[model samples]
Target: MTDTQQQSPQARATARIIAPVRHGLTQAGALAVLAGLIWPAQAACIAWVISGWAAGDTALGRTALGAGLFALGGLLRAALDARAGALLFEAADRTIARERAALIEREIRAPGPESSAAVAALAVQKLPMLQPWITRYHVAMTRTRVLPLVFLVLAFSQSWAVGLVLLVAGPLIPLFMALVGMAAEQASRRQLDEIGGMNDMLMDRLSALLDLRLLGAADRAAQDFRDRAEALRDRTMAVLRIAFLSSTVLELFAALGVAMVAVFVGFSLLGEIGFGTWGGQMTLAQGLFLLLIAPEYFQPLRDLAAAWHDRAAGISVVAELDALDAADRVALIGTGAATAPLDGPLSVDLHGAAALPGRAVPLPSLQLRAGEALALTGPSGVGKTTTLAAVAGLVPLAEGRVMVCGQPLDADTADAWRARLAWLPQVPHFPDVTLADFLDPRGTGADPWAALDLVQARHIVDRLPDGLETRLGESGGGVSGGEARRLMLARAVASGGDLILADEPTADLDSETAAQIVAALTGLRDQGRTLLVATHDPALAKALDREIAL
Candidate 1:
């Protein structure tokens, strides 16, 4: 199956759409308010039925009608409570979504070589696990633990004898659920971690498919995936086993609590015990009322075991996501603090730039006059790209700074400083639109043919069916090596007129084409535009007024 198809159903359900909604009220507060409202409504029905029936003038038919209306009100209250529970569930889901978006953005903007694999795992694998837990577990915990206690207290205000037994037995449901479900929580947490790790490993193997095939290691990769899949299956089964046992245990106790209440009522009716001795003795309807409401109070207990299990899994995910966000915040600040601005003479200072992450090789300082052409000579992978990155303000520098036009530039907002400087990297990215649209962000009329001609790329454009109007095919997907490089140079020159930083601008072209491109570049130099070219070709390096070696 494709990766998208392989995504767990749980992940799809909780897929983050936007920022998460914040948690507004504590579970305790909500339970208190809900239970308070329920108490009055429940009590009013009891008094209405009992008091009306006590009057001798009330007919049997009238009593039954009054009872049915009271039951109808109870049904409406039940529906209202369900709606309130759903509102809280959606709020919790929103909160989780917002948190995930913020974390993902932080990770993307982070500096240097920070791997986002761990962060992605938490967002995709762990965040979904928390969704159901947030909704269902929260509801269960409140209804099982807090609502029962609130009802028991209100029951006491009506009748002390009936209230006493409720107070004693109500707590047993939660106590038993907790004791039995403890192991389930631990198991679910372990299973969740295993699932996240497996997800990471699977993604890694897939991304490295080309490398594994080239190195003849496909079998090893397959075996590794198989082992991880087996481990995930084992851990998942362990979690399910514990979950089933805990749920079964909690259900048994809930049923037993109901049975105990029934026994007390039966004995009280027979007068085997005093009315106040065991539980209150009253009419069949009164006894039936307490019996009916007792199980409803603890109904949330039946799901307690599963709720705790899910909660443990969810906490594990939130903790991991928070850590990733913390790390990203640190990286963003670290990149901003390492800008070093170099000084030049009386004219425009073409100061050197350095990016964060260590310099792979030494880059000598550069100073240039308005008319001078400087060449940076180095083999591949020597700090040449790093130098360009520093100048562009993309990477954080370990040491040194870039000063331009005789003024020290702010390293933090390098792009603002670069607005006047032309830059062409080894590989440049362009949009999917036509060449003219790519060059003009503000929709200014730009002659694509003229720009390509200046960069010696006119013939390539003319050969296309649409010429200047032809699309670059999204980040230059269909362009040949030489065409992409030359088009990049055209973009930089078209975009900015002053200083140009060209990395291997002529490396992929024919000798005649290279010469023509060099001639065009020299015209810019003669026109007082400063140029810095990182090249290994001795012929091209020697063509410059000055050269620097790594």
Candidate 2:
């Protein structure tokens, strides 16, 4: 039967809880079971040698045979364990990569701006915590479930009393562990939240450090950051103390259980207690074998106790990832289609379009033919950008159908429609790479320097140390606002999109730059590209072919 077909309900639930590590868990369990089966043979061989010594029958041939069997079992167990560890590590690495990629894709496709700082924390910092859970804790859990039962049945066949003691003590370990785990779960979740908050705080403060310093509040900001770090440290130490205490309690129970089995075997050999071995006295070899296997029976439980904290952390990480993937937030624009180039200039139509669900304003229906240039003019907070976003399909429409190239905009065609258009957001972002690479990632476009020359941004590139080869930081850190705006314009011209959407493209530019932008818009209009610009600039408004006041 297939593995999925053979899985019990409990195993299926576990697989769901840690779906990424299911394959690793199955392979590890099979290896551990093989090792557990070999353990008994190793123990019996040792007992046989000891009993022969006790009987003064130390024949070299029998002794050598037992020694060889013990050695072979030990080597097999070690090899199986090594293989299981390697398999789990690879599985964990792949799982983390897959989760990080999925989170990024979801964020990029989401309708509006998201908390990127929080998403970074989840991907870069929190996601890797699953490694130990899959590699160590998962293996321990599988062994704890499998090896103990195997040892118990073996013990029962020899002496039911020893098996009964293990059976009683085994359940108590998990009982105590569950109680400790409950507290750990709460503490772990708090730690994760605080860490995410700390990351967001650090990013925000760093971005606005100049403003804080100018306002003479830098010292206060520093103090606040210090306080947060100290609080996080204290929380971490508290969790560690609880973890150590739980480990101590579990060890005490495991040690006591093993000691009790040793005492019972000792008494049986001494003829003090003689009522539990199938109405027959145990041979010295049988008693010795039982005693040797006693500690092996509890080893799996001890390993599990050591990995309990990993379980807590892993479950929390999975919960965070699930929250990221849930559709409780705003919807994204498109299906998972690769964007394609437009065949020609396209018309845009907004029928009964309105701002997203919570807004009070309803947008007027409008139609623009191919190659027309229109400007949306409105007061501040009058939904100019919202209208542009609605047109771009970047925000959900409350009661509207947007059509481009005579086809209605839906998830199925959104990506292809977006591909046909170029967007210049009010706030632009550039990846951390050389300027030439940022403008043309595929290295298949027109000369970036030539495009920069068209928008009067060539000087900005020439002034840099490496010219077009100079690397930029996040959000184009080295460039001024005007320079960034011009770069966006340059990129749009180079992209050759049939439709263009520019939001406040001339807001931060000087008069000379504004004139250059006007000329560029004129050139794009003459070339028959449809243009929609959202602006408060009267100069830019006069330059457009038509204006729509919202």
Candidate 3:
């Protein structure tokens, strides 16, 4: 087995992300094991007092000392247990928050492990499952490793028969747990995968709810949701069933071990049996100690069995994290962060660049000087937008290089090159923030009324309840398509970038709306701002300075 495979399930699965928390887990486990070991000393004290009383030497001082020592051990155990619990909870919380933030930040800057909805489900719902495993499983695992052996030695120190019974019973629980864990991990993984899929389905249906209403397919949507829900429920039940079965097995073995020890100790103390004890016969104190210590032997094993399912679930979540790290996606040309503009003049040039990285679908050379407008005219899949994206340094090229604003569009200069341009995508998205914040994302505190008036969109904003402070939904919920396009244009104008890159700016609009958008593009070009538009509209193409057919 590999080094990772040899580690515990949680470690093997989550080591990439959870490394920082492992030390905390170890510290907490040591404290828990220390607390657990005290129970034996406490039991010994109680046994000594009872034996003294049975000998008719019930002195108050002796009894008080024994009781005090037992109480002190109990208090010490409680304190250690409480401290371990606190540390474990803190460690788990810290790990969860850190992973969630890292997942979200990485997704924002790069392509994520899954869809947006699935990523959301994983970050918000699925990740917290690690807490139970971290808090319960690791401590139980520690106890199982230490307490079982210590209890066996202590049992053998008193009676051979009880020790043999514990030895036989203890190993059985771990073996059974190992068997159940294989199936439990599979079930937990399926349940988490289903959750992500269900979230994706819900997001898709909600996004297309209007279209579904128009087509009168709400019943089909509901049925699909019902089926997904049933699958999730079934997967969850499978995990639970495995957990219950393992728990039953653990309890059965534990009860039997304790019962057999009781029989051996009780019969020996009663002179009915004599072969199991070290001194040929069991005393009252030995009998009491054996009965008290028998149950403690199986407690750690029971704890481990109970937490075995949590380990499976936690491992599945960790597996998801590792999957996210390995998933392939579009490579950003630069760091995809805001930076100062590169030193270059206002222009764009593409010399037979490929549409995608590691793909040999090259395009024609396109060049534009300052204050020129060019249209990329092609069919739907003719790489028009891809060409534009390549020029914008949003996608990498296979062979030829793109020069933007006199700078090579590579990782070193892509962010700076992009800072000198504005992009208007086919569909505009707005965060749930005020229009002022959306338009002035850099928080420059500039007046946007001029840009808004320039694009003929001030009238639309003037009618809104909050005007510049209006908070728009992600899809610009209350805004018409043309109006949203106009708002994007205003942002571009306000951005003060010399080049404007628009993709299908005139698509899905009426003649008047399309004309206004076209006029706005023409106006930007006339004002000495460079323009590159990908469009099929003949009017939009004719209005531009020249057209490049892909």
Please tell me which predicted candidate would have the highest lDDT against the true structure: 3
What are the Cα lDDT values of the candidates?
0.63, 0.80, 0.87
Candidate 2, residue 131: lDDT: 80
Q: Which ten residues in a row are the worst by lDDT in model 1?
A: 16-25
For this target, which candidate reaches the highest TM-score against the unseen true structure? 3
lDDT: the better of candidates 1 and 3: 3
**Per-residue alpha-carbon lDDT of model 2 for 202-277, expressed as tens digits?**
8888867867998999999999899989988987877797799898888888788888888888899999998778
Ranking of all candidate structures by their TM-score, best first: 3, 2, 1
TM-score of each: 0.60, 0.70, 0.73
Clashing pairs counted in every model: 14, 0, 0
Q: Per-residue lDDT for 1-550 in model 1, tens only?
A: 7664465433432343211332332443364346435644565566556656665537777667666766776776676566656666677667667777776766644532334455666677677777666666656665665666665665564446667767666666667666756665567667767776777787777767867998999999999988988988998898787767767766776676667767776776677755643345555555556676667656655656567777666655654553444442323322333223333332334344454432333456777666678888886667776666555555554456656555655534454445556777765677778877766533547666666667677787778778768887655766776677778777766764467888877775787667766777777677677887888767777778888886
What candidate 1 gets wrong by more than 4 Å, as runs, is 1-23, 26-79, 82-90, 112-114, 128-146, 153-169, 176-203, 263-282, 302-305, 325-391, 400-413, 418-550
Ranked by lDDT, the better of candidates 2 and 3 is 3
lDDT of 1: 0.63
In model 1, what is the error at residue 292, expressed in angstroms? 1.8
- The order of the candidates by lDDT, greatest first, is 3, 2, 1
Worst 10 residues of 3 by lDDT: 353-362
TM-score of 2: 0.70
lDDT tens digits by residue: candidate 3, 1-550: 7686577756666575446888988999999999999999999999999999999988999999999999999999999999999999999999889889988877766654377998999899998998898799889999999998998999999888889999998899889989988999999999999999999999999877867988999999999999999999998898888888888887998898899988887788789996987776789998898899889989998899888888889989998887786676556678878899877677777886564423446676989889999999987667888887788787677778888767788999988888888889988899888999888856688999988988888998999999999998898878998999999999998987778999999987999999999999998888889999999899999999999998
For all predictions, the C-alpha RMSD in Å is 9.8, 6.5, 5.6
